[model samples]
Target: MKINPLLVGLFLISPVFILLISYPGFSVVDSSEVFQVFKFTFHQALVSSLLATVFGALAGLSLSSIFDSKKYSFVESLYYAPSFVPVLFVVFSCLNIGNLWQISFKGFWGIVVIHVLINVGLVGALYSKILIHRLSLMNRLSLVQGLGVWRYLRKIVFAHTKKDLLFLFAVVFIFCFTSFSIPLIIGGVNSTTIELLIYEKLVVLGEVEQALSLALLQLLFLVFFLGLINFTQAKEKAITTSWNPFFKNKIFLLVPIFSFIVLFVGLWLSASFSLGWFTELALLPTLIKSLGLALFCGYSIFLFFQFIFSILPHSTFEFFMSVYSSPSTVLIGLALVVVSSVWWQGRWLVLLFGYVLLYVPVLFKMFVQNFLSSLKPALKVSRAMSANYWLRFKMITFPLSYSLCLFLGFLTAIWVLGDYALASLLLEADSTIALVAKNLLRSYRLDQASFVITIIIFCEFIIYLLYKGLAYVGGQKY
Candidate 1:
């Protein structure tokens, strides 16, 4: 019998589908509370997105003024560093920083501050590249016209990138809205987000019905925003030049840069002072387990997506695959927990399997194009030689992108290591370093949590180096 590729793919996500079908519906009494959560989530997300975008735009413009185009790539990476670091660590760092100022980073303002810090760098880095490229096109004509900086910015810079600015706002809004770790950590009872609400329903209240309802609502909201936004934008190449239009106003750029430096310093001081954390035996085992889980999840997600993308034709079916990746991590974790009795053994395997399921969509979105490009030449060679399916896959397909596979594995592994939402639902207290650190943070053991976060950062750097090393050895540019 022949099988449809879409049907086969659907079977993989049958768990989520089952949960949607089995939902007991939303309760009338809970409507007001649910609406309150929704309101809070929307308000915080809106404020955070607006602030991050403005500040990021300023930082981007500042960086463009001070740095040559040749240094833009380095600048981009430096700014984007915070986003890639573990969310838990970032939250912990912010909390430590707040403590120094006698500030309470535990409510609406706290949530906003952390979200801005985490996302500002991303917006700045991405916008800087585009702004700098536009800088090269300015030349002396625009300058000779005596177009004042503010007037130039208003008429030229902002006008030209309005669409991108809107897109950036939507992107940041979505990220902050669905944010898990930051809100989960610092968001007290009054400021709980929908994502955290879902976790509470499932983990604390055991309200599967309510959890499912909340999950569906969050999913619908995200899909609406995501549909309105375009995911794919043409990436403009970086223009390498020595020209600087805003050289006189470089002072403004230092604010965001200095802010980031202060946050890092606070995190460093917290970690460095916790010298006794190094002697804990529990830390070692926790690290090893987290490492093992990360490796397993990463390679599994890499291979799983590689196979699925290869088999599925790039059509509407491929687009449908990314839907599963959009839902909250806590939602997916809860769904798996509900259904684990039927098909899962309640072991770490369930967590591993769930990670692969959710992570595939993410990896698919990231690596699908790369996979297709790599396969084209190999498939051509195989077809010319009249190779069989197995032979083509074994000899040509896999070999061409082996380095990419390893690199993706490394990337996903790092992400899994730092993730707290999914692991929160599935793993035991001492199962992973992130979990342990989060628990410590919850218990107000700041010193111990800081040390754990430090180790996690150290592990991430090592993994990144390995990814680069593999790419170099395989003759692939990362």
Candidate 2:
């Protein structure tokens, strides 16, 4: 539980990555070009995630409808298959399909379609499930009263739908806004995203200061928007997610069937009806690489969870509130002095640590809340027993939480391995499989791009299977 001095320095210096990356002068940056560029980036991503969410909702609705319960289960499983597949795979699949339709995958609209198709499955799946559950519950009452489905939705469905729709749009905006791989791969010079620009300035141009500045600038903008969303949401009435979803409508029913036709057509154009994709020997190496990365990432995430849980028993707000408020730059200075005295020289490790801090809020919120839910009752029981912290947590908490924690770790890693921002920090390493995949696109080798994407899809399916396994196991434990 002891804090390492080396980690201390890295956490302190994290923000400088952004400050260092900006162009030399804010004086000149004020020209309309900067504002225009920023506006373009924001609008494109906003539009994309929104559309993706609508499609995602439809995607979920489509599968959840039409099919009977038994067959719907199968369709539901396939409906969500896209979220795991890498964005590049989606792009290449688009490219292959485009050749037949004469559709070009090179512009803003084209990129949006790929992002929507690939990621909407999650929004749809979750949204649909919630809707179906509610609908089933509402149906019981409606059937008794002889009220119609529309009446139920207008009263109940609308409320639930609003929350999910808002949430889905917010998330879609963030993903598209921050996305690197998909935009960079399919976007020609005409379609450069802020991430690509950051990469160009920092990695390609070696303008670390400018890149850091831009990165920081983008972060600030995101904080501002996020703050506004929070403020607006706070002003509104609080609506809890109702664990119910209904989808007996005709429009919702035919959606997944139509989507399947679209998906099938894309797959057909992509694979070109060749069983070669099924038999290719090249898939093995890429698969091995993806599996290795997923495993390491998964394990690392679990270790991190274990480390945090052991070190801090208090709420994360209580734990980080003290440290986060302090200017990290000052802390880094102290950490640097301590490291020097200790003869440590892992500056790169320090950078990695900083990124972890930057990304911690999202992942932490997702897992820590889950962790705490299980801890509350145990802590209370310990209170009754007059047991000390370690005694109660050791016997009750750790064992009970480790499996779910492992499952959390696995899901987090799968998410991280595909995480563009996290992977961006470590892209220089030989183990940068995502970077290697990006490089495949760089070479403009469509066939090679095809290979990388095929492998990505396979790896995702494995991860998805593992996640479902974890979900099943976790469900049983509860």
Candidate 3:
């Protein structure tokens, strides 16, 4: 029997709707408190998005100039390394760096700093690729027209990229607005964001109604913004060319270099590098469980994407999925908590369900839909030839997307392995290494937390190698 991807999507997202409809009337929350949290959330998101865009644009410009050749493509991955790992690692890296410099990272500015660090690479990589594709032809035109650098940038470059930058700003703003783990860990009391506020109400104060209301409010804002902005990548054919002279300024190189130095150096300085404590804590079981959970989550996401891919080129479904954002982590955790209570032994199942729901939209937006979009022309051609769905997928889709799927699965596993926010609410105990590390950090054991983070990094490397091996083996079969 054929399954509808849209129906599957609806079922996955039903938890949010379930909470929204089942909300038992309105409960009064402090108006001042809600407003205060909202203000901070908006303020921080604005600052972070703005700073990240500026730095990211500069880094992108620099990268486009320096790594213009195909041989330098692997080095480009360094710019994105900070973004692919879980936020926990970024937070610790920033905190350790702050300690090294004797600076405090415990308030509004700290949150902004960490957010910028996490997003700059992503924004940079995107902007760089866009510039390469969109500006290559324009660069030649500008030079032939004898356009000065500043004038060309203002009149041509900025004009072309303004919409793209706005869209990126909105994307970054949304991420910062809905941020959870970062604020939960480093945000001082005065800097609590709306997400953290919801967590406090639900988990700390047991104010279920208020938490649900806040979550709904957050969702409304996100939907409103999403409705306003339609982000479409430029489809202009990439012009093969030499370096754009305007981006040849070597000073812009500092942006990515500085980012890399801070993350790696901070990790090096902070990690205790001792396995004695790791063994003493008897955490091997927890580590193994976490790895297993991560592997499961990764495989589930891969299969889900495969299902989505099989039913390709559904415009309405793709549009909706592209704009869809999951409800707050706290809200999802609440829904699953109630469900788990009824199912009793289904804690793992519920946990996985939540992970899928939260991550599917993200992966779809970032990778799946893009991959599907690229296959549309071929899909149409296959259909016109009266090709079967399975045949088309086998001959065209799977071969093209296999590597990306493996990479996405690997990334998902790493993220799940490092996740603690949702697991904290659902699990009865600290069953994962991430949760244990979080607890240690909360208890002010920085060294121990850093040590655990190092272990996570090692595990991530091992998992990455395993995925690479699987890819090699699978490739041999094809």
Candidate 4:
């Protein structure tokens, strides 16, 4: 039976509908308090996005110099590694470093610093790729014309990449704006973001109506920004060029490198032999539960994407998925809570469902969309040849994209492993390692928290290897 893509889109978006339908009558909330939260949220997000974009652009320009070299291929990973891991680890590392240096990583500037560190690498990596792929020819011609590096960058590079930079800025802004965990951990009382406010309203104050109102407001802002920005992916093109000395500044590379060093070093410095706490706290059960949750979430995300692929080349559905933003985290968790309260033993199911919904769009934007776009020609030809949907997916799509799916799955698993925001809302007790780490951090037990984060990272590495092995075996089978 042919499935309508709209139905699939509805399935993906059902949680939001549940939220709206369950919205209780409006309750009076402090307008001035919300206004202050909004102002701070907007101000911090703006500053963080601008700083991240500038640093990212600098790093990207520096990276473009070595883009043609196979020897430095791994350098790109450095720029992305900071943002790839869960924000919890990043927060733990930052706090650890702060403690070591006797510096405060709390409040507005602290939040901005963390945001910049987390995002600069991603911005740089994307910016570097954009330069190499989109402006390689322009770069070569400008160099040959004896154009000064500064002038060429001002006239050619900035002109070409401003829109891309703006897009990245918007992305970073949204991240910082709706950020729950980072702000919750590092943000001081005066630095509370709208997301944190929502959390407080729901969990601390038991103000469900006020929380829903705030969540809706946040959603409206996201929708407005998303409407203004057209997220068009650049087409991939091969460029062959020699190394240019002008773009070879290593100073900019240090941004991402230093960020990476800070994380590991801080973790090392804060870590102690905490073997006693592990068994005494019954962390083994939580560890096992976390690993299972990660594996299950990863597989679930992979399967969801596969299902999306099975209904390929539907413009309406693709467009819907492209524009649809998952509800804010607090909103999603609240909706699940409402749903779970009605059914017996439905908490885990709804929690898993919430995670899949939250992350599917993220993975789709990062990797799946481009991969799927590349297959349009093949999919079209397959359709023209009377190939059934299953045949097309089996013969053409699955083989080409399964590895990517596996990789995305691995990423999903890592995110889930480090996730505490949703877990804190859904589970009554600390059921995962991330929650345990969070509690330790909150309790001023930095050493124990660092040790727990180490275990989480180790779990991530094991999952990565498992995924790699699966990809290898799948490749051989295909």
Q: Ten consecutive residues with minimal summed lDDT in candidate 1? A: 230-239
lDDT of 1 at 430: 63
Candidate 3 segments exceeding 4 Å error:
1-3, 21-23, 67-71, 143-146, 231-246, 470-478
Encode model 1's per-residue lDDT on 1-478: one tens digit a residue: 2235687467556556867766746643287898899999999999999999998887777677755555655565567767677888777777777778788888899989888887787777656656655556663445778888788788777876775676677767877888877887788879989988888887898787777778777877776665555454333334454445653466546545655675677788687545556666367777887898888887786686556544544455655653334567777786677666566555577888777766565555444533554466557777689877677667765666677677668767887888877887765676788888788888888788787888898899888887777777767532
Q: Model 4, 175-284: lDDT tens per residue? A: 78888888888898799899999899999998888888888788778867765664543444435444434466778888887888888887888777678988976889
lDDT of 4: 0.81
Among the numbered candidates, top lDDT falls to 4
RMSD of each candidate relative to the true structure: 4.9, 6.7, 2.6, 2.6
Clashing pairs in 4: none
TM-score per candidate, in order?
A: 0.80, 0.71, 0.92, 0.92
Candidate 2 lDDT, tens digit per residue, 1-478?
3454335334534445334332234322333655666766787787788877776776655554544676766666656556544555556667767877797877688778766666566667666764664455554465577666667656755555665566556656766777677777677777877677767765676655555556656766665655444333211222232323344543543443444455545644544223464345344554465566666656666666665555444543433422222122222222333334344465434433433454344455323533554466666777689876577557776666677567656665555454444444443432444545566566775555455455555566677678678767766764
What TM-score number comes out for model 4? 0.92
Question: What digit string (tens of lDDT, one per residue) describes model 3 on residues 22-41?
Answer: 67665778999999999999
Total clashes in model 4, counting residue pairs 3 or more apart in sequence or in different chains: 0
Model 1, position 44: C-alpha lDDT score? 98
**Which regions of candidate 4 deviate over 4 angstroms?**
67-73, 143-146, 231-246, 474-478
